[model samples]
Target: MEPVSLIVLLAMGTLAGAINAAVGSGSLLTLPVLLALGIPPGVAVRTNTIGILFSTFGSVYGYRREIAEEKGNLGPLMAVTAVCATAGALLLLASPGAALDVIVPILIVFALVMVIFQKRITAAIRAGAERRAARRGGAGSPATDGTDPSAAVSPGDDLSSAASIASAPTPARSPYRSPALIGTMGAASIYGGYFTAAQGILYLGVLGTFTGRSMKAVNSVKNLMSLIVNLAAASVYLVAHFVLRVEIVWLATAAIAVGALVGGYFGAHLAKKMPEWLLRGIIVVVALFALVRQVL
Candidate 1:
């Protein structure tokens, strides 16, 4: 690639890292640049995975507080995600390249639909959680309300009344193992293997089951999860490149790592201040761009 092209790749990687940290679709930036620079599709996937690894690190560091609190549960989740991702990466290597052209577009389309339904899904989960909490109140647990049972109503009445009280918006909670987490990790591994843009959104949508955090908190976990999966994928890619000896296409992976580190930090910081809707809007726009680009 020309120096000019390399420069463009670096810029794109940096931006991708930042946006990825911010809203979860950094691949759209790097992949096009890779293809534009004349890298083969298979090689591009490997290098992009390498580059995002740094960004993942940066984002995780930036969100360390949130992660520290949730660290106890991360081991099992990361183990599952990493193993599944390794399998996905191996599958990518074994499959024929032309096969990806057919598969990738479908994955992109499915991800787009998933993005559209993200909110409704979250809302439904929140509602279901509220209902369960209400039922639990019948056991004489503290109602979400602060009032004491002895002060006013009977425990039975308080329990029933808890059902009538306005549902508190569920805060994003700490991470733990769950069926949702397992399924999401599996799905994300598949997505990571195929089309990786906005993979964070899909993971977060599922991780929502265990966490009731703000977007920033969720993003921290997202970065941590992405780091685990991308690193596992990168290991497979490294073996494919070295052991299988695919041609070296470009040298921007290290730079992507550096840029992503910086970008992820900022992305996490910005997510704290940015409204969820705006961040989400940015994500939808990027996802649409990725979908259109893949289709065209």
Candidate 2:
């Protein structure tokens, strides 16, 4: 590659890494930049994945504390994600890109809509869950003073009740483990492996809606899951490159990877200070831009 093109790749990769750490979908920026610079589409996609791997590593390191705290909850999900992601990567290697071109825009729009109304959706789910709990309580015990059962616990029972709640079975323990949520996450991983653009948005929506965790926590998990998907897909790409003699732009990859590493470190710090709404807005705007670019 020419010096100018290398410089451009580095700059775009840096910006992409920062955006990815803050809100995700940074590939939307780097992939197009790579294509516009005259790289073959196949090589560009592989190189971008390799470059973004460094960004994800940096983001994970930045969020190490959060990730460690959530490791128990994330263990099963991560295993499932890795298996599904590898399947998606194999599908990508076998399928034609055009097959997903039409579907991807629709998926992006749906994710944007979900992000826009996430608060309302989450509120509704919470209300529904509470109502169910109330009903269950009413069925087993008659009301004594018209007080809420949750508030009627005796002082001696408080510790036990809290412990029971904490130790509930995984599925009933949290909305994050619901069947719907697990399915959504599985789908998101598959898509992430197959076509990485705007994947972070999908992950954010899934994690935000179901996990009942703060954005920082969700972002930490997102970074880990994305790292798994990229690693799996990159492995497939490497094998195919050797078997099919696919070209890879090593110089371009090195430039972008170095930039991504720097940007991701700073971006993780930025995420700690970013407001939720600001991050959501940025995700929606960038996803729309990518959708439009794909369509036109």
Candidate 3:
């Protein structure tokens, strides 16, 4: 990569990492930037996978407390996500170039829908959590989900408490029993395979359906779930592209990984400080812009 391209990639990666960490759609920025840089669509997508997977380590680690809590809850969810995501990744690898162009717009729309309902989704989760709390006499409530709605606990405390709950399970069953959960994972896998812009929204949305935790609590879950999803997809990309696109693949992967690390830190910080509304608003505007770009 030239110095200019490298610099641009770094800057984009940093912002994208932050966005992914904070909001979960940094690919909207990085992927487009890669395309603009004259990278082929397939190469760009593969490169982005590298960037996001590497970047996610930092973002997920930063929220390690939340991840730990969600890990226990993720047993079944991960199983579904892994299978679907792997299938999607393999499909993308096998698909012809013309197909991706047709698919990108649809993925963008799916992402847009996810972003639009982000707040409502989180709200529903909280409401569910509240109802669950009442049913359990406030005993088995998950303190955090994606963004905590409760006023009683600090975000930090809520995250820690939720982690505790996840680790203290009595049920031997997995959390992926819901039909809605399975369908959403399939949908999310498609979106991740086609384009990961706003995947966090899909993740958060599905998570909301299953649990009643704060958004922060859910976000923690989203990040970990995303990591698994992305990692599985990334592995497929590496295997598929290893022979034909070695140089570009390695370079793109390295750049994306580095960018993801920087972006992850900023995104996490923003997630904690920024209100859901602001993030939601940005998601809406960006989705619209992307939609228009696709349609026009």
Candidate 4:
């Protein structure tokens, strides 16, 4: 382990953690570096997943208050994702990486699309909700009646803006019982447990599109759920390392874990301050870059 490689791993881990907490696809940034360093693919994947568990811890702690508000909604979703993650981890051991190569890019693209179109999609959702209200002779479209200021999110508006949070009374909703939301999360968790790349992107896609929360609020849940998925997968990796004698580059793992922990905590604070549009822009750029790099 040269000093240069150690520095690079630490730097990469820190950046990856921050990106993962603020946006997504942070693991994509680490995998190529690990592979370039001559670590085996299996070991690199396991190391990255295990390291991410610490990242999740730091981010979760940073979002502790928001998570406490959503705790009632989290129990069921956590159970679902953990179980799915276990299944995915077992599948990873049985299957070759080639099987998911194509699907990984597709998932990234889906996440990008969700972020890009989030405003319009949110408008349409609000429109429907307003229409239902109008049928009951309540306030109609915010655009038409102007009775509700918060109902219409302007084109330049960011749902996660500090101004919005201060002036408006928009509380985050989990809808954890929604079948569609559950289905999306279950699938993402499986892929997350198996591949460990771009899983946050997938979570953002589901949370951003369906949760109707500010980007910061959605991010709080994303970090928590991502943590649950990673821990379950890491559990499997640890079991294999001990029982099956699977190898881990412990030095590399230590560097990533320590770096990610610090990075994740700070990244959560960064995300909390970033406007929704900025967060979305970062998500788009990272996901697109990942897509092009993955495909090429």
In candidate 1, list every pair of residues with a backbone clash: 55-260, 171-212, 172-212, 172-213, 173-211, 173-212
> Which candidate, 1 or 4, would have the higher TM-score against the true structure?
1
| Candidate 4 C-alpha lDDT tens digits along 96-149 | 666546655665565556456755755665566557645756445455665766
Tens-digit per-residue lDDT, 79-143, candidate 2: 77888788887776776656545554565565566566756765676566558767878776746
TM-score of each: 0.73, 0.71, 0.72, 0.70
What does each candidate score in C-alpha RMSD? 7.7, 6.3, 10.9, 11.0
Q: What lDDT does the true structure give each of the candidates?
A: 0.69, 0.73, 0.69, 0.74
What is the TM-score (0 to 1) of candidate 1? 0.73
lDDT of 3 by residue, 1-296 (tens): 67777776776677677777766877766676666666666667778877787667887888887667546556766787788888877777777777766676576666666676767666776577568657776454455344444655666676878768656868655444566666777778666755667787667766666654445566776787778878888887777666656324566566767877877865568655778677666556654664565455
lDDT of 1 at 196: 68
lDDT winner between 1 and 4, please give it. 4
Which of the numbered candidates is closest to the native, going by highest TM-score?
1
Which 10 successive residues of model 1 have the least lDDT summed? 166-175
Error of 4 at 133 (Å): 13
How well does candidate 1 match the true structure, expressed as C-alpha RMSD?
7.7
Q: Estimate, for each residue in 14-76, the C-alpha lDDT of model 1 and write its tens digit.
A: 666776776576776666566555555666777888887788888777778878987886777
